[model samples]
Every structure is written in C-alpha cells, then in structure tokens.
Target: MTYRDFPMPAGLRRTVPGGSETGGPEAGGTVAEPAPAKASATVMLLRPGTGTDGLELFVLKRAATMAFAANMLAFPGGGVDPRDADPDVPWAGPDPQEWARRMDTSVEQARELVIAAAREVFEECGVLLAGPDAGSIVADLTDPVWDEERDALLSREQSFAELLIRRNLVLRTDLLSLRAHWITPELQPKRFNTRFFVARLPEGQIADDRSSEATEVLWAAPEQLLAANDAGEHRMLPPTRVMIEQLARAASLDDALRPAERVWPVLPAPVEHDDALWMRAPIDEDGNGLPPTVAARNGDRPQGELPVMTPWTGGPLNERVTCTLCPNPSPMTLEGTNTWILSAPGADEAVVIDPGPLDEEHLQQVLTDVAARGARVGLVLFTHEHWDHAQSLERFGELTGAPLRGNFPGAEPVTDGELFEIGGLRLRTVLTPGHTMASVCFLLEEDGILFTGDTILGRGTTVVAHPDGQLSAYLDTLEKIADLTTGSVTTLAPGHGPVLPDAAATVRQYADHRQERLAQVREATVGQQDRPRSELADLVVAEVYAEVPRNVWPAARQSVLAQLDYLDAGS
Candidate 1:
C-alpha cells in the first residue's frame, strides 16, 4: 500500500511489471542522465499452503488508481523513509555490520533497508514482521490496540522506531532471508533499488487485506500463481515471476527461506524475444545470478565421524520428511530439538515424531507447518520421554486432536517390531534402549531411512544417560541400527543436529565412538579404581573428554558413569 507510486529516492530505473526496461530512446532519441533510484524493500511473505509441502507466497495487486506500479502485482514494500535510518531503532538478530556485508551496502543504509522492509510490511498489510524479542515472533495482532499502532505507523505520526520501542519490540531481522537485489533500468523518471526478502508468515499473524494501494491481496502457492499468470489471470513483473519460479523448486517453506550464498544485483534489460519486446535479467532459476550453495545442513564431518553439526535450521529432508528446528539450542540440545513430520507424497494424513520442547512458539510452528503441508496428524510418536523431546507431548495432542503413541509414561504401548501404515508410509519401530530404556528408532520402509532419536545423533555422541540408560543395552541397539543401515537404511534423521546422509557409516562411527570412550574410561581408571566415584568420574572426563566443551562435561560424566557400571569400576 505504501508504494502508492512507491515514491523513491532519485536513481535506479523501474522495469514496469510487463513493460520495457530499454530506455532513453535507444533508436537515437535524445538522452539524459537517469534519476537516482529510490531506496526500497520488498518482502516476499510466505506461508505453508494447504494439502502439500509446497509454499504459498503473499502478493498484492496495486489498484489502477494508485500512483506507482499501479495495477501490477507486488509484495509488501515501499520506498525507504529517512526516519527508517534512525539509530535508536530497536534491533535484533544479525547486526547491521553483518547485514552490510550480506547485502553489499553501507551499515547505515543496510539498517534502514531492513527496518523499512519490516515497517512497510506492517504499514501495508497490518502484519508485523517483528516481535517482543529476537528469539520470539509476535503470534497475533488482532487486538484493537494493535490496530491503533498500525494506523500510527501508516500515517507517519509515529516513527517505526518509536512504535517498536513503545511496544518494547525489536525488528526480527533474523527471521528475514535476503534473496536478491534489483535496480530499475536507468530510463524511468521514477526508479527503484529494491532488496527482495523472503520470510515465513510468523505464527499467530495473518495477512489481512487492509493496504491502501491495492484492491487485491491473496496468498497462493508458487505453481498456482505461475499458472494463473500464464493464463493472464495475474499480471506481474519479471522479478516477481522469476521468484515464483524459484519457489516452485523448493521442497518446503524452510527451503524457501534459505538465503542465497551470493546475492549479485540484477537490473532488468530489454531483450528481443521472438520479435516481441521482453525484459530480462541475469537471474538464474534459483533466483540468483548463479546457482547458490545454500548453507550446509551438516556440521563438520556430517555423517562419518562424530562432530557437532552445523546449525541446521530445518527444512524438507526429502519428499516425505520435514524437520522443524525448535528454538531451544544449547550445548546439550545441539541446535534445539528437531521436531519431525513424516507424510506420504500428496497424502492427507501424516505421522509426527518428537513434538520437542514446550516452547509455545515452537509448538505453534510445528502445528502451523503441519497445516501448511495440508496433512492431518494421524499419529504422534515419541522416541523417548526426555523433556527436550517430549515435553510438549500433551500440548501437541491438544493441538492436533491426533492419537499419541510411544514408550513414554502417558503414551500407549509400542513394540520393537510394531509397524504403522499411514498416508502410504510404512514405519517400523526398532526398540532402541541405550539412550533410555524406551528410546526407539523408526524405520521408514519407503525411504530406507531411520529416525534415530537420541539413541544416535547427527553430530556428537549421545549420552547413555546413566541410571536410565545402560551401556550394554545401548551398545546392542547401536549394533541393531548398524545392521539396518547395512541393509536398507541410507539416511538418519537424528533428534538433534542435521540429517546424516551416510547412515551406515554414521551408525558405525557412533558404535566406534562409544567403544573408544569406553576404552578411555577403562584406561583412565588405571590405579584409580579405588578413588571415589565423583573423583574418578571427573578424572575420566578430564582425561578422555578434554577436547569436548566443558559445558557438556556433566553429560559426559553420565556416559562415564554408564561405562563404569558396565565395567564394574569403582564403588
């Protein structure tokens, strides 16, 4: 709505939605220096669409009565206001300096662009892209109080900074992923330098049709929009159309949010196509100047060796598997718990594994993601009852109205060989009791992949957990997992960290690490078996786990205790 001709600063030419970018009388007409493009931001707001993993992107059709890019479809965005550069604006996520490097702009300009992106979306659609803090996103703004603030922002009576500070909120830049940069071809009297961004529809927030510039606002999946455009149903620019093309390739909404590795700027130029005038840019199919190397989903030595995994924020692992990273990251919880959803291709029913911790936002994220997939939670299964994995169990049951089953206290009983068939997926339970007496793994009969809860991790070694976990039983479970990997399993979706691409090798590495740690414990006890258990445990941890983080030494101590119990070491 703010784009009412989206008044921009002088410079950057405009490539009309379906018009020519070739400018200044290319056929020898009089020419003049192009005006400087106005600084602007465009948000490609996305959400899970119904009945599939494909994502729905939000778009607005500017009313023909409006000034800028009128009657053309665009995302929520507008020219940057000077007030947006205010240093006092509440900020969170990556700092301006980092954003500067990422967006190829000055720190001050980067700050303004980010704030403008967040602000324009709110002013136009009444959907705030910010929250009370960096780690949290506002869920709902349906209250009348929010409407008042939205009005204030739109009218410029209150600066975006003042509104945020007054509400004690911060612009959650971390929620934004910079996709590409584009400059209008240098022939237009009014031009724009726009930064394109993609962000998920934050939980609890909905896109309302309230913008002043547009007569239409809707959310449709990438393919749906493309098909509509092809049919002359939705008119759009090359940038918007190309972006939709990219979204069509995304396996899930999470995949769509992954930032391009290198964002080279794009300026649409006119090209002759089949004797017809066309606007073209150097953007690739993935919406970049070239193919992008997305952030690695695996940490150092992803599968073969035991090392902490990279921060895998979660995405579609395959056609049927999706991981939603919880917000609870720590030394113990790698990168927070990974709540997994399993469904068959195009099935209406799905199976959820590990609801994860009780963070309200996380629970809603999982639920919202499931809805996006357009699948009903047919069954909820827990790998174990650790709070990190099952704390939200009952709350999830309340959210989905689905049956809950697992080895946990309140869960209905499941057996080692119990098989479940849902939405065309065949999952078999493999009782894995080393991490806990009830820790289990689910083998996806179709994919030959195993959901190895905490019994095995994608990165680092899992704790036997002492009293609750036994080294002997755990060792046997590893062997079982290894045997499956040797046969049908190829990938491992761990409870924490990235998915292991090499399941056989990863399982073998886990088994070998356990044995190696046991050997170290045995050697550390030489002439020290007579020492007190605490002292001996500390000694073993210091000698064997010196390379591991001290913060996780307590968990290592548990493993040491399990090893001690198995070896009958110390009193």
Candidate 2:
C-alpha cells in the first residue's frame, strides 16, 4: 500500500477545517484522521446512451496500506503530475482562461491541474476521455506504440500533452466540468486543494483501474452508496458523504449532470472548540446576500400569537423563523437534532449551540454570519456527546476560537449547577442524566429558554436508549425537568424538532407518553408465549407507536429493552 503525504503551500496557516478565519475558538484535539492533500477528482460518470442504464459513479477502495485514504472507498483520480501542463496536445473545448478564472488560479497552472485530472482518470480508470482521431482503423490511444508514451508520461519522462500530440490524440477538455473544491483542514499537516470533476464514461470503453492505490473498485448507484454509508456499512469522507446525499435526491443521470456543470465550489469549513473537532462545507455563496440576523430565542409575543407552524416537509432548510434569522420548528431526524444560534440580545458576539453535523458548508455559513455580525463566536455549548450533535464541536470551536462548554467531561463540562456567561446571556446547566446517561439541558436566563439535547424534545416521545439510556434515570430526570417547568419554565427548547410554547405541558406530555408506551409494551409481553427480541419489538412497535416508521423498529428495540428491564426490576 502506497501512502502519499502532500503538504500545503507555505505561509498559509491552517485555521478551522472549512477555510474559516481563525483565532476565535480554542483549538480542540484533531478530529478524525488528517486527510492528505492531493489534487484528486471524483468522477460522477454517466452513461447517456440508455436512460434505463441510470447513473453510475466510478468508485475505488484504497489499499489499506496507502498513507492518505487507506482502506477507504474513493473516486478514481489522484494528485496532479507536472507533465499534464504540456502545451503541444490537440485540444477539445473550453480554453484554459475560462477554467483559470473560475478556479482562481493562473491560466498556466489551471491548464496543468485539468490536464492532471484528465490524465490520472485515464491512467487509473482505463476510461479514455480523449477523442479518437478522424478515420482511423484503431483508436490512436490504445495502440501498442502509444504504450511507451503513456508509460513515459506516467514516469515523468515526457509531458502528457506532448505524448498526446506525438500520437495525434485530442485532449478532451469538453468531457469534464468542475464540480467543487476541498481543502484539508489546518490542524493536520497533510492538505490538498482537491478539485472534484464530473464526466461521462465515453463510448466503447470500460473502466480498468490500473493503479494499486485502491484494492477494489465498483460502480454503484448514488442511493445504494448513501444507504450503505448511512447504515454504517461503508466509509466516506465528509465531502463524499455530502455529495452522495445531494446526488441521492436527483432522479436521473441528467438531473445529476446538470448541477455539476454549474461549477459549485465546495468550501472547507471546520469548526473546533477545546474538546471537539470536525469539518463542514459552506452552505451558501459568501457576500451574495445579506447576513442573517440573530433572533432572541424567547419571543416577546404570546405563544398563540406566534405564527402557527404548518408542518413543513421540505426539511429544516425551508422552515421559517419568527422575527429572527434562525429557523423555527427546525426539522430533525428521528433523534431530534435541534440547532440554535445563541446571540446576545441586540448584541453581535453571540454563541452557537449545537451546530449539527460535521457538515462543512453549514459551518462556513456560521463563520461568515458570525464575522458579518462584527463579533466573533464566544462559545460552543454542547448538550451531550451523542454522535449526531457533538461530533462537530471540535470544528466549530476551532473556527470560532470559542471555548466549548458542556455537561460532559474533557475541556470543561458544566457542573450540575454551573452557570455559563456568554456576552450578556447566562446559561445554567442542569445535570439531567438518562436518555443516555450524560444528558444535560441548559436554562438560558436571558431568553427564558431551555436547550435540551435529547433528554427532551418538542415533538414526539424520547425513548430511554437502554443500557446506555437508563429508563429509571430518564424517568427521574423527566420528573426533575417537570419540576423546573412547574415553577418558572414557560417555553420548551428541545434538542430535536421545534421549540414549544408551553414547557410544563410538553414535559408532562413526554412523561405521560413514555409511560403509555412502556405500559403498552408491558401488556403485549405479559403472559404471552416467549418470542425473539425482534418479534417482541415488532409487536410492541405496532401496538405503541404505530405512527413511527417500520424501518425504525431496530431503534425501538433498544427502547423496548429498557422498558423490559424496568418491568423486570419491579417484578
């Protein structure tokens, strides 16, 4: 296994993961492996001949011994070679100037990068994107005479374009389009200004991966790949993960190809704090729109007067914010991932709470917004260390230079009664265990808001995750939160979904709902013939939460396990 270590250009300091302006948040330890910088390309190859053939991406699994992407699934391309810049080759479409302007590189350099990308694609994948000479009995590129030229070019004995010109083959710039760019975050020594590209696999040629960089290769549909990744069945870098997620939404190859031609630049934004680190891409174009304004978490108007939310289906992106820039009724996955921007009321130096996912773009938008406010981020407060929420902490903190504060250890976990001061706001931590042992919620005195990670949510019921998520402890924690609401809690801010108007009512509903589910599960299991755990879960899910998706039954089984443990303890 060959391991390549590519270093970044000198004098450029590595800041946050996603090209964020550094020096706000304290540095967190490196999160994930430091990705080696390489000018690699991910070709989203399409076969336009038959619509039924669908979209197929050429993919490779790096050899386990390779230094950069060892043992990982990847696209077919590698670092740029100097020979790719030769000026003698017959050209296809767009001139180098257009690419240079778009890529923000010198015309000479941009030409070389594109050449390298094309050359590497052909050499490793065996898909010759270059055009065949007119009226030739055989494709000039496949001729045995050209093998020496190809080998010499690969070995840096000759220029790629010179090899092409010597054999009268045309370089197919027309076949490729710029997709996005990614830079490895600064925390690690290895970095690359990787430029991803897209192209169609030409006619009469099948991909033959020649490099030993990858141990295996396959061409799979985007949806299949994303499913495998989501199910923890495949490994993908953050960029690959996001692109696959985006591509899965498209219906056909044409739909996917149209977007790639638009030249969207993927900005690397890694947010970091004292305790965590991760990367995300920027969400939108910088300086193209007005900066978002931070809204007070607690509104002055009454809950009934607040605009009634018609359940949004376009996911969290389309959700509307009430008199604030942050989305209200933030859409969430089953686990209830609630995200909030904690700005000082009428002040700029606010804190961001629970920047969800290691999404590079969203983190970049966050830093851009923070910078626009004329005040940098002061802190990133985590509600818990669950994979869904806290994974991006290190990146967010590193980008903003803010100290991270949470209820768990490392860096600084807020004590059961510790108070955190950010700008003019004060957040009091309540050590509410259960719903996964270390769960904690924060009471924002400035906004009268409670930021609950997963101990509570605004919609649906939270299951005691079992073993790790204890039922008894969770129930006890709920009772305690209910106690707070009964006294002064007016609004409910949960980790998942939207904020609620009535805190006390919501807490009571949560408690009652869990009890109801447990009771139903208990009834279904009692005096029945012994059954497998999967069978018991299926029966209990249908009986208790018929509204929940059947696909989530596996998750429900964990909850059912806890409920059974509680019932058995009493028996």
Can you write out model 2's per-residue Cα lDDT over 345-375, one digit (the tens) per residue?
4556776667767776767766765555556
lDDT of 2: 0.58
Which stretch of 10 consecutive residues in model 1 shows the poorest summed lDDT? 20-29
TM-score of each: 0.46, 0.42
Judged by lDDT, which candidate is best? 1
Each prediction's total of clashing residue pairs, residues at least 3 apart in sequence or on different chains, is 14, 36
How well does model 1 score by local distance difference test?
Answer: 0.74
Off by over 4 Å in 2: 1-42, 48-53, 133-150, 259-264, 272-276, 284-571
Best by TM-score: 1
Q: After superposition, how far is residue 120 of candidate 1 from its true place, in Å?
A: 66
Model 2 TM-score (2 dp):
0.42
